[model samples]
Target: MLVHKRVVRLNEKPRIRYGPMLIRDQERIANLNYIYNCNDIEALWMLRMKRAPFARLVQTFRSRGLLQDSIHTSVEEQVAMFLHVVGHNQRLRVVHNTFRRSMETISRYFKQVLYVVGELKGEMFKSPTGRTPTKIRTSPRWYPYFKINNIL
Candidate 1:
């Protein structure tokens, strides 16, 4: 049987440099700006939810013992990572690059947020009361149709 051997390099550290900037520094700067300076429209596009809604979700989960801020990652950042994964159907590597987090960190928090969100599915998807709005019922075009169907 043939055996495969790996060679270890001595006195060498992984080098990640882009021109004059370091990769880690670039990622940190990008993540910081994206997370903090994003407008509501950008936030909605990125997360598939508005800022207020996302904040509400984070607050609810925090209050329910589902999520908390760790030493390195905050609750908001965790939720954003979760959204970036689910909303965009992105892989962990992409999330790592976008969020400036390690793959392990991205995977861990992704699973955690996913579990908590799944547990809170009932509240998240609560059924409507099936009540029609009065404005819609009273509309000229809708009134005749609704009256014919006895819907109103």
Candidate 2:
């Protein structure tokens, strides 16, 4: 048996440039501060993960007075909570342990906020203009996988 050796290009240094940091505009900064200061863990989580849905949920909750007397958690906190949950997908107890809050509180707040998000997403998806056309005519063999996959 003959053995062959392979040569590798190991001397190529990657050209990397660190871009300058971008500062937020005054209005955007103010809005971010307001959201960060005013939202709760659940609210913040929904906002960060699904901005449009979160906004809709917050609006609905505000209109219904559901959040009027609730604790003064900032939108930023809510966003942070969402990121934490998404990053960990752990149990409620795990979330509570991580967030330093009781499981009951986390569950209650998360459910309420998520309910609103679900409703908003449903409504948005139900709109006729939001859907793709059922019949999309394409040339035969243009996408062979489409025929193979029975999608054509």
Candidate 3:
């Protein structure tokens, strides 16, 4: 304990040089190339949706006048990052590493996409009506019971 306190020049922390993506301009360009040229399957693998559906979703967002490209990032990339994080249950740092973005960028865009998509999601989920649907009503097994209900 005495030696630890007496140690000199130990307080100067080493300068950390971040590797690859986070530090270079070229890496950011490559990130664009990745999603832009990636095939449907690859897009699905990374973003949890195929290229066509991804494009359509972006188009939907654009058409609604909700989201737009930022100075440093595009709407597509923003959405992709958002989807990748949520779809894979990843943390912000994971997304930052994968997307080659800073934590701030990842968080900002994630929130943006989340807010916009959440805003539009109301259309997908309608209020439940107090009625049995045609499928349930028509299906005897489902409406009445799936099993014998032996306990009852």
Better of 2 and 3 by TM-score: 3
Task: Please give the range of 10 consecutive residues that has the lowest summed lDDT in model 2.
Answer: 1-10
Candidate 3 off by > 4 Å = 1-23, 125-152
Can you write out model 2's per-residue Cα lDDT over 23-55, one digit (the tens) per residue?
A: 323444554555445546643453444455556
Candidate 1 residue 109 Cα shift, in angstroms, is 0.5
**Per-residue lDDT value at 29 in model 3:** 72
lDDT of 3 by residue, 1-152 (tens): 87776574477676798786545667767876898689988887888989888888898888888899878888889888999998899999988877778999999888999999789888746886756667876787797762344234
Cα deviation of 84, candidate 1, in Å = 0.5
lDDT of 1: 0.82
Error of 2 at 106 (Å): 0.7
Candidate 1 least-lDDT 10 residues? 1-10
Tell me the spans in candidate 2 whose CA falls farther than 4 Å from its real position: 1-60, 63-69, 72-88, 124-152
Candidate No. with top TM-score: 3
Q: Report the error of model 3 at residue 124, Å.
A: 3.8
On a 0 to 100 scale, what is the lDDT of residue 30 in model 2?
52
